[model samples]
Structures are given as structure tokens and as C-alpha cells.
Target chain A: MLHSFTIHRAAALLRAGEISATELTAAVLDRIYAVDNAVKAYLTLLPEVALAQAAAADAAIAAARAAGTLADLPILTGIPLAIKDVITVAGVRTTCGSKILESYIAPYQAAVVDRLAAAGAVILGKTNTDEFAMGSSTENSAYFTTHNPWNLDRVPGGSSGGSAAAVCADECLAALGSDTGGSVRQPAALCGVVGIKPTYGRVSRYGLVAYASSLDQIGPLAKDVTDAAILLGAVAGYDPRDSTSVDLPVPDYVGVRDQGAGDRGLHGLRIGVPREYFAPGMQAEVEGAVRAAVELMAELGAEVREVSLPHTDLALPVYYIIAPAEASANLARYDGIRYGLSAPADSLWEGYRRTRGQGFGAEVKRRIMLGTYALSAGYYDAYYLKAQQVRTLIKQDFELALQDVDVIACPTSPTTAFRIGEKVDDPLSMYLSDVFTLSLNLAGICGMSMPCGFDAAGLPIGLQLIAGAFAEATILRAAFAYEQATAWHKQKPAPG
Target chain B: MSLTIAEVEHIAELAKLGLTDAEKALYREQLSAILDYAATLQAVDTSAIPPTATGLPLRNVMREDAVRPSMPREDVLANAPDASEGYFRVRAVFESGD
Candidate 1:
């Protein structure tokens, strides 16, 4: 089916003139219509906008072909993709999965969105997210829960759950998701797709609607490593508008991948098995799948060594502190007077309180209150500053480990997707779901989650590969090597 | 590290969120548990360690001070809850007849 085509395959067909962008887009839209009611991946569908973009892409392709400059066009042209609702799209409703911005129309687009448009990528629509991208499960969305494409009863993992689910369901070729903590990778792990959280500052955060400025980063969730590499190559680079965006030249990920295709076997690749990542109480099947995948990497000519990040256990506390503290400051913009929901009250202060109180969901409010306490007077030094210091220790751990190994291989999540509502009421338990994936964001390094194997019930397990900052190419090559050696990447969820 | 209802309310007030009593009680319990879990950070001595606020070393990123096209005031104010002539209208900072 055209809906199942990867970005590379679809682009090849479009370049070959065997399929029009419009036809490919229509097939995806038709699939969305057929399965979205059961999956609920999207908060808003852009059928009209997508078709318009597809038509424009077709024109561009035709013109390029006529001029014999088809090779010069970006690979993203005419590739339909989904955007997490947290990203702003001009003239489109960007809800961020919150009632606060339920009716908010973005006045301007995000830097990443502009890049996608420049690449002639067709945006399918905005997918569901945790309110303000705060929770691990999409159940925290003000809208509705995004059911896992593999099993509707289980969650897709989250904050970026909907984006992951959409990709797994073949609703789109690939999708963009913002990761704060494990928002991107964990969901990708649970949903059985490839998701990468680029090193901090690898992608622009200009219009991401900040959840945690220091922790949040935009990355891709796709069917395979190559598609992820293509999408990452398109969106990654220095942006003048984002202050934290690194000024270094963006690596040509696809070009590098092609160049390394000759050495696809992981010959001499140093793979570090972080002993801390394989925590107790993790599902046995999940651990077995990941360990087996690591052994495969070793057998494929990679050197595997056990490593330790002694402070790894402290990452969760530090993340909860730093993220919510930043969120408390960032989300303060949603007063009654500004864009989004405003509940009128007799006094301005009352209005502010009421609007925020009513607009934010339970998880958001919990985090905000926790952050307020952490940053409030008398507690700032004890909570926030202490977390930052510990955060330094966490970052140094990665630096010291990467000094020896090229990449760290671990399980993306402790377990596969859990049943919806199983941990909704228990915030701490939900937070534990991200144990294996959180340190990458804390350390400001790149990491990816690709399917390694499935559990007894058929849910997918993800093998996480971590690399140093701006070393996305290394992880891509490693994941691609593993993917080529295994059939896991080709597995897809049945139609919802 | 159990939080009281009053502490929860105080934190909520500091955050500018007006919560119902039920919410306050609920958050009192949840926030307390999360904070209790976070108390583990205290065991790690950071006396000599400097705090890391950002992931990258770059700071104060300045773009060329070139004037570019800005969003139209109409468009900017279009999403405002209340607006007047070319401005976001808000309730008077001080009550009238004060």
C-alpha cells in the first residue's frame, strides 16, 4: 500500500514518475479516514491543507523533472508526515493537547515547520500530545487518549504518543515529535517504530511551545532508520531565531549513511552496555529481547563492553525537578489576557488564577505546583539548584562513558506498552516508565529507539542507541546496521 | 515530606492557579509523594559542583540587529481574549475609583 511506503521509497517512486504526490497523499488520507476513529492519533486532520501541499509538491516535481534538475530536489518533497500538536503551524489550530490552547490559532509557524515546507513536505495534520507535553501517557491530553496501533487496550507511550502511534499505524510515512525526558523515544519504543531524540540544540525549539526549555528537543519518529535519517537531515541545522540552536554545520546524515553502506557490518564499533539501564523489576521478555539484540551487535563484529553510569539512578529526580521548574516559568505566559482560554473574573488576578486553574489538566497542574514549590523562595537552593548540580554529574557520566565507547546500547523502556489507565492515577509509577531513556536528554546527547524484537503478546521492544552530542550519524549507522541484520524494522501493526 | 492542604494552596497561589479544595487535597498528596521521591537528590553532595542550566555551552546568542517584517498587529491581537484599537485590552491594573 502507498500508505506503508517509507520516505525513501516514496521519494524514489515520485522521482521515477511512477506515482504522483497527490495519489500517495490520497492513499494516506484514505487510510487515516479508515483507521483514525479507532486509533485517535490526530487532534486535527489537514486533508485540505495536505492535498494542497501535495499538489504543490507535484508541480515542483514536474518542473524539476522538465528542467532535468530532479536530483537537486530534497528527499522530503511530497512525503506526507504528521506533526505533534506542540509545534505551531500558521493558520492552523495548534492545541498542544491542552484546553488552554484549544481554540488557539498559531499566528506564525515554527522554524521546523518552515523547514519542512521549504523541503516540499506535505504535512498531514497535528497529532495528539500530553497537555503542554507534560505526561508520559496521552491520557493527560485534554482531548482523548491515543490507542496503541498494536493493541488498542495498551498505551502508545507518550507525550509524543500520538505521533508514534500514527507512524506505527501507517497513517503517515514519518512524524515529528518533541522530546522532553522520554516523550519521543519511549513512545517510539512502545509503538514499535523508530524515534530519535537528537542531542539538545540539534533541532530548533523556536515554536515548540516550551515544556522544559533545557530538556525539550524535536526529533523524528519513522518506520526505519533511513527515513529517520532523511527527516532529521531536513529539519536539523542552525536557526538564527533559536538562541540555543548550535551554529555548527549540520551533518548530511543520508549522505553519510550512503557512504557507510559499504561497511554496514558493525566492524570495530565499540558498543557500551550500560549496566544501570537494565534495572530490576523490568519485564523479563523486554530484558531478554534487548540483551539478545546487543549480542547480535557483538556477533556482527562490534565490541561490547559493560559500562556504568553510577549516578544513573538519580536522573529521574533531577529531570522531574529541572523540567517542571522550567515549565512553571514557560507556562506562565498563558494568563487570561493572552491567546488561548480566558475565564473572566471580577479582578485580574482572580481571572489569571481561574483561567490557569481551569485550563491546565491534572498532570500539568501537579507539575506546575511541584515546580512552584521547587523554585519558590526558601526551597530554590534545596530543590532546583541541587537538581542542577546533580544534572552536571549525570552529564559528566555520559561524557566519561562516551570517551571509550562509540554508542551505548540499552532497552528503550523497562517494559513494552502498558494497559491504558494502568498508571494514570499513579504519577510516580508512570515516571518510572522512562527510566532507561531519560538520561540522554539529561546529558544532552543523542539517542534513538528502534524495534529489536516483540514480546510474547506481540508488543514491540526497542533497543536504544546513545551517542555523543551531534553524533546522530553514529547512532543512525549503528541502528541501520542492526536493522539490516534483522527483520524487526519491517514489522508493522495490523490495521486498527 | 507530606504536604498539607495549606501548603498545596500556597504553592498553587504562587503559581497563579486557583484550585478547588478537592484539587488542593489531591495535589497535596501527589506533589508530596513526588517531592518525597525527589528528596533523594540531597544524598548526592554537590558542594563543589557547579550547576548546569543549559545543555550547550553557547550563551547569549545574538542575531544581527536587522529589522525584519513583524507579525501584523491585527493578526497578533486576533487571538487575544480582549482587544481594543491596535492593542491587547486588559482589565485596569488598579480598580476604578481607587
Candidate 2:
């Protein structure tokens, strides 16, 4: 009943009338009921709403079959999906894992949510995240922490931790998550799910609660590469509402999926192994796993080469500066005057003070203060401006490296998931968790993390695939080939 | 060591976050550690580099100044915590502070 059905298998089953959408949705819902108590992945669940959507999908499949419109369609019809807390789903609470927005119900759906609905995916629930999507671990969630499905004692990476955990636990067939500095990919790697962070502006940020505006892009968390591709095809496109949304034409992601790795799969594909990515501090097991994945690609006919992104070491400091600076500005709207939490006080200043004081979590408040200081009057030139300059150098480094390679491969995180409270008290260590993946975001490039191997403790380690801007098809093809060759992606966590 | 209480308060004001004296002391310590760590950026030598604020090279994306449709006032105020006749109601800012 709980085999890891790839998107293709699930779609075929639904189309053949062998499995009703209602039955699939009920199964996932039952799984959630069975395991969510231990994982705490979902912030909210909508069983009735999901069941209704599933029934509708079943009817649509029947009607489409009768009308002969069922052939050559988008893949994800009748699939149940979970959404990150940061992405708004109209009429659902979009807490963003913060006390500030704990009671806030989005008046409108995020553009990604609208597209997912259009693709006939059922909305199962909203998942938890770090407050304001500001932390690397879901431990910063003001309400609750999403436990790693592999081992509940460890963390599911954040701010997409809950989304990854939900998919890992089989609570949902697929989920949508946003990545800013590896938020989506890191957790996906930690939780052993396929997480894709589409190139900046590849997917619309219209209703995504802003966090590092230019750096944030919405993508998918799925059980496999095919599902991630199907979900990305549905959500990636231009949107007039978002000024930063790219007008580039969305590619036929499903076409790329069906093409698979063919004879030329990884043949002649120039894969760059960045020296900075394999620096001295990376965990030995992680380095071993990444090397094995690279070797596998080499055996598959890819020409592997050593490359240097000289400015790569600067990515972490630069990202922390710029992301927080933008977040400080983006989060300004959540003042006491708007919806969400508001603490009553005698005067307007006092009210604003009390509201914000009680609303934001400790880590969020720390980041906001840090960001505000960086962008403040006198310090702007020294901190924020310098970081921006370094960011350019980092992007240039990627551009130079891409000249020699079509794609780059590395470990998604320095190590696998750590214990829940391990890095919560140390901000620097937590920030460094995204070291390998941050450069891709700064360069506005697409990247994905696929299950490559497991740590000594049996925790999954993710191997990252990064490509130049708008090279998602190539990245997905390579990941698909690797996933097909390895059975790591198929492993599931035992229910507690 | 790097951040003073006054600097912390100044930053708190900029962020619109209120802090108690005790919290201010805590931030002074936390901010000191963070600022010291962030000091590593100073070694990068970006003296002649241009700041990159966005990925796209395009500039001047301004729209034409033309009249456009607007949302109904009722719809605009639908989600307001408190709304009065044609406006958002809020706690009075001042009763003549001077």
C-alpha cells in the first residue's frame, strides 16, 4: 500500500481507474494521522478539503477519458500535496512558522498555489518552517519543530524542513517549498527527498512571503526527480504581479522527463568539481558520498573536470548579509498595524513595540536587528555595500567556472542532519550549514539535491546538481539518470 | 565589545523592535559576537567593486504613468483589523505630544 510510486506510476494508476483519487488521498491522510504525531511536520491539515479535491479529480479523470482529453496531459493530476508555511493558500493559515502570523489566514493564494491547483493537485495542509524563513533548522519555528523522519531526534533541515519531512514521511505525494540560501535543498537532502530550487525568477514569488526577495524562488519537494519536474512545470512561469518574475518562456519540463538519460545520458556533459566545495572542513562521509556520485556520473559518460570558483568562500558571508538586509525590508510590513499578532497597549508606539516584541521569535528578532544594522545609515557602506560587491565576485566566479563545465556537483550540506538542538544556540554554525548551496542562489542559478548515500548513522546525504541559469532541464536529466541507477532515492523511513 | 547599548537601542529603533534593558544587554553580547564574525568580510577588498542588488542587468523598468483600474475600497479594507468610514482605523498616534 505504501510503495514509493513515482509520479509516472501514480498517474498511470489514477488514469487506469485502478486507484481512485479518493483512495490515494485517504491513504496519505491515514499515513499523516499515523506518523505526524512523531514528526510534527504539518502546521495544519485539511482532510475534508483534500478529500473533496480528490473526488473532483477522480470525476475529471473520468470525464477527460470520455472526452478523449486524457492523452498527453500534465502529469500531476489527482496527487495530494503539502505547502510550506511561507507560501499562502487562500483561506488557509499562512503562519510562516512565526507567532506574528500564527492566526493569519491568507486572503489570496500564492501564484504557485494557484498553479498547483490548476494542475489538479490536492492541498493536504500547510507545513512548518523557521520563523520568517530565517533559520537553517526548523527549530526556530515559534510553534513547533519538524522532526526528521529518519530519526526523530534530529532536525529536518529548514525553512522547508516541514515540507521535506512531510514528503519523507509519506504524508503527501509532493509538496511546494521556497528556497533562499538552500532552504529547500538543504532540508530535502537531510530528509532524503528530491528538492529543486529553480533559478531565480523561474517561479513567481507573488504571494510568497518575502525573505531575501531577489534570492527566494519557489520550487518543489517530491518523492522523486520526475515528480519534482512535473511540479516545477506546473508552477514556473512569468507573473505580472511580481516585478522580479522572469519573462522567459517556461520549458516543457515533462518533455525533458520523458527524454530521460538516453544513450547520451551524461555523455559529454562537463561536470565541474569545485575545489572550494570539497574544502577541508566537510564531513568525511559526506565527501565520500559526493565523490561516489561524481564517479557514478563519470561512469555514465560525463567528462568530469576540476574547476575553481575562487570567490566561493565569500558566498556564505555575502549571502548572510544580503539575505538579511532584504529580509529586514520585506518583513517591515508585519508591523502591528497589519494583520497577525498585535499586543494591546496604551499608545501607538507602545502597541507597535509590544506587538513586535511578542510576535517574533528570538532568532528572527536577532536576524532583523543584524540586518537593520547592516543597512543602517552609517554602516550601509561598510557591511551591506561590501557584501553586495562580494556577491558580484561570487557570481562572476560561477560564470567563469561554467565556461568550463555544463553542470557542477557537490554535497548538499557539510554533513547530514544534526541533532535538534545541536546548532540552535550557535548561529554561525547554523548559517554555515548552507555553505555549499548558497553560491547557486547568489548566481541566480538552478540546483537540485538527490539522495546519494547515507551517513554512518544511516542518515541520508544529498548530492547537489547545479547548472547555469535556466539549465533546469539538464540538471533534472542528470539527477534522473543518477536516481535511476541508484536505489537510495527509494528508501523510506520506518513509521514510529 | 564591538556594540554598545546605545548602538543596540539605535538598531532596535531602526528594526521597530522594542527591547527591555535586560534584552538590550543580551543583544549587546550577541551582536558583539556576530559583528566580530562578520568582520571577516573586511578582508575581501571590494574597494573598487560595484554593489550588486539584483541578478538581471536591465535597469529602468519603470512603468508609464497612466491611469489604471483600482480595487474597490471595500475590498481593500476587507482584511483590515479595524476599518472605519473609507479608512483604516488605528490607535491614535498622538494627543498633541508637544
Query: Pick by TM-score: which candidate is best?
Result: 1
Give TM-score values for chain A, per-prediction.
Answer: 0.99, 0.98
Tens digits of lDDT, candidate 2, A1-496:
6324666688899888789888888988988988999999999999999999989899889899998888754567888899999998888888999988877878777998888788888899999999888887799999899999999999999889999999998888889888999999999999999999998888999899998887999989998888898889899998877888878998877677567545636776899999888988889999999999999999988899999999877888888788888888888887666577878888888777788888988887888888999999999988899988998898888889999999999999999999999998788889989999888889888999989999889999999999988899989878877887899988999857
Whole-model Cα lDDT per candidate? Answer: 0.93, 0.87
lDDT of model 1 at position A470: 93
Q: Note the DockQ of each predicted structure.
A: 0.87, 0.64
lDDT score for candidate 2 against the true structure:
0.87
Which candidate has the highest DockQ of all? 1
Query: What's each prediction's TM-score?
Result: 0.99, 0.97
